[model samples]
Target: MVGNPDEPHCVSHLHPETAMDQIIPFDPERMIWGSAPALIYLEIAVRVGVIWIWTIVLLRWVGGRSISQMSVVEFLLVIALGSAVGDPMFQADVPLLYGMLTILLVVLADKAVDHAFRYWTTAKRLVDGRPTEILREGHLSHAGLDKKGIGPTEVMEMLRRAGVRNLGQVEYAYMEPSGTVSTFLYDQPRPGLTIVPPLELRRLPAPDALSGACCTSCGLVRATADGTCAECGATEVTRAERLESREISSA
Candidate 1:
């Protein structure tokens, strides 16, 4: 929009000559949506048919995992496919064969990446990344937490979403590549480190009552209060080991 005479400052003053930038070139020919030749239309039809059927079959073979828990590669594959197919579908300037070639290339690249990931550890790490261990032995992994930029509250929120009350109840919690956390709750409770804080402890066994002690620094519970914390290594001992309620992690 052009600036008003009285409200001149309302306009962008970056360009000295506002009119020069404001002037847009319009082509009369651009208004025309010309039709293509029969051969070109046939090419588009064949390309679309092949790519559509190929995409459906490939996606079906890949299964629901691609949609449900998409890895980085899977997500990229989807986007590239969309971009490749979309341009050819509507853009007449983009040749039908060119679009088909683009789709095929994307699909082949996806397969290649998949094959590499299956066989090569380095490639797998590059594509899917190493799964971050957020919880281990009932204790939150400090390095894991720092790497993911998440804290006790965030971990507790994940546990809550997973329908867990205590970290002692979980043996392992992994931050997967697809951004979903996989938590494994133990059948029996044990004295281990917990990510759940004191204020928000839920229906959990009391630390002192059970075979565990709470860490003075990070609140990770262990088997005993006398020893250093497995999580923070704090020596200060106060084992108020009652299980608390849960709070959604603000982080």
Candidate 2:
């Protein structure tokens, strides 16, 4: 068959038994040191060093938020940069110049998107998503939690980490775009569902029967319960725990 003189023979044209040998061509020395000359290894090191320094400079320009509190755009930038910076380090076919250009283009796109997010409210909401209200007025927002794909247990864990003793201590709680929970506590907290003692424990201290009960699922306080939560339709109800004065003073 006539073929380009410069092009190698196609594997399909080779003998069936030899095709596998040609495809794999396993060599221990080639595997250890690669096919390139030893000098090429030094070139690879230089390319990697230059790219590493350039990446550091670009990251500095990108700001601390890109590294620490990455949004969707920033996350995309990281993945793109990883691919761009990694390929040219050892792949002889990929030029260092190409990798640098790719990195620059990715960073530029990220910056452009960031600028658009700042100027356009709709674009910002669509890309990064708006902060969701997880809790309001000592009660969990089931709709907000569902929208954010977070459960009550996760919200309670976040609150507990923030040193909250009970849902009553929180005036408002929001799930930020960075996936962090921000809590605003009341100066004088009302009695609500307790979050202490850990939920895993099957037993809890006896609650005062005369006091009002709170929905264990949603932390909604009611004068009395008829064995079901009105807010979330959960059957579990527990005594509303008040924030002690000492805890407020310590806080």
Candidate 3:
């Protein structure tokens, strides 16, 4: 019997005996081209193009900070947009209209959050944590590092990238809400622990050769006679290295 061209075909109805074998039949045409008409490809492209442009406009409205220095809220917005924009691109079942609505709602929610952050200090603090002091007067703040779950070595690496050769070069350093480190330098840098060669590679001064010492753990400077760091109580100390005038000139 002839079947209607518009109606879906069922292998089970045609051949009940061979239905089990046809359950997952290999059809290359169906797999590659899908069951939709060829024109659907053009529709998908149009949907993608429109959505891409709309997303760009919405992101621009949200401001560049969303991409550059993302806070927790901005990070979540990125994740939501990724899922919203991707599925409708290829899935024939997902309508472009629904995807567009989803994106609109997501961006609106982000804007609402920004509005709340602008007016409410408590909301801003809760979502994006306040900046924590990592260094004060060239000394590492162990308490602050512990609060932020960062180590002294990691803080030193950040300072090094910011053009700081030693702890004394930094008057203060803060770990911002965006996870970036900000360093403030002193007018005349004092003698402190060197971080260029890294702690592991640098050799410690012998007991007889020691003139001045700095804590190996937190980079706090100590008197030559002092056997322990007053700031961190670390007994292991290395020779304090001074930041040269030539280094300042080069910087």
Candidate 4:
């Protein structure tokens, strides 16, 4: 056969044995050896077990960081899961069918757990924990702080992120199951409040003089300078301003 000196032997397929070698070589060393069934299963079990423990520990440790840590865990999960799958794919004696089966089993178990979380309250608590009240009525919940392993500084940070400059402005603050701080403000905010931001306002006293104030104790929309709140009889109030509803509507 005539061929270029620089190119491979293109006519090698013309030889009987050459054609057979190109398709399925007689060299069993490259693709021979059946793995033990028990060993293969054991390997799969170990891989899945390690991955499971890794996932649990990672979430639990970083969960205190809340929203910031969620993205980190999710991003790392992709790399970890890919590594888990690659081992079974490249192992010479491991069967592709077995690898796929293990993956399916994991998926099914995950789905089952999700179902339990949705339907069972106890299961949800075990997995996601309960919403702990960290602050209420301008007072810190000591038990909540201890249970969540958080201090005043962390609480302030969470509040700032939520656009709250003052803790007195918040009625209730909860550490939610999803590792987020949820804040609820009072109905009427006090005016010229003595309490400032970053500090936990322990005791809230009734207002003596109201100049542009809202009754946080009651739903008082209007602020009066001379008298107590007409709606809730609350003397203590915060600064009150009319919310322009040009862009949105309540009813």
Best by TM-score: 2
- Each prediction's total of clashing residue pairs, residues at least 3 apart in sequence or on different chains, is 8, 0, 0, 10
Candidate 3 segments whose C-alpha is farther than 4 A from its true place: 1-68, 206-211, 224-228
**Candidate 3, residues 1-251: lDDT per residue as tens digits?**
99999998777657455544543434544434556676776665566456544664565444323344777667767877898889768755455655676677678778877999999999777667788888988789999887777788888888878888888888899988777888999899877777876777767664324547778788787676367678777888777777898987886
lDDT of 1 at 236: 56
Clash number for candidate 3: 0
Misplaced by over 4 Å in model 2 are 1-68, 205-207
lDDT of 2 by residue, 1-251 (tens): 68998998678865566433453333544423455565765564566456544654565444333343676566656766788889767755444555665677667667776788788989777666678898999999998887777689988988888888889999999987767789999988999988885666656444466768888888998877666776678977778889899976675
> lDDT per model, in order?
0.61, 0.73, 0.73, 0.56
- Tens digit of per-residue lDDT, candidate 1, span 22-123: 433342222122234547546645765565446645554443324547876676678778898898676545556666766786787778778887888898
Candidate 4: stretches off by over 4 Å: 1-34, 46-58, 61-82, 86-99, 190-251
Please give the range of 10 consecutive residues that has the lowest summed lDDT in model 1.
Answer: 25-34
Candidate 4 per-residue lDDT over residues 1-251, each given as its tens digit: 67788987567557466443454433343334334555766776677767765775666655555544343334334555576478666665445556665676566556666687778978756555668898765445656877887765676677767765444456788988666889897664322232224334554444333435545543243445457766435565555433323311321
Of the candidates numbered 3 and 4, which has the greater TM-score value?
3
Per-candidate TM-scores read: 0.54, 0.70, 0.68, 0.53
Model 2, position 180: C-alpha lDDT score: 74
lDDT of 2 at 143: 89
> How much does candidate 1 score in TM-score?
0.54
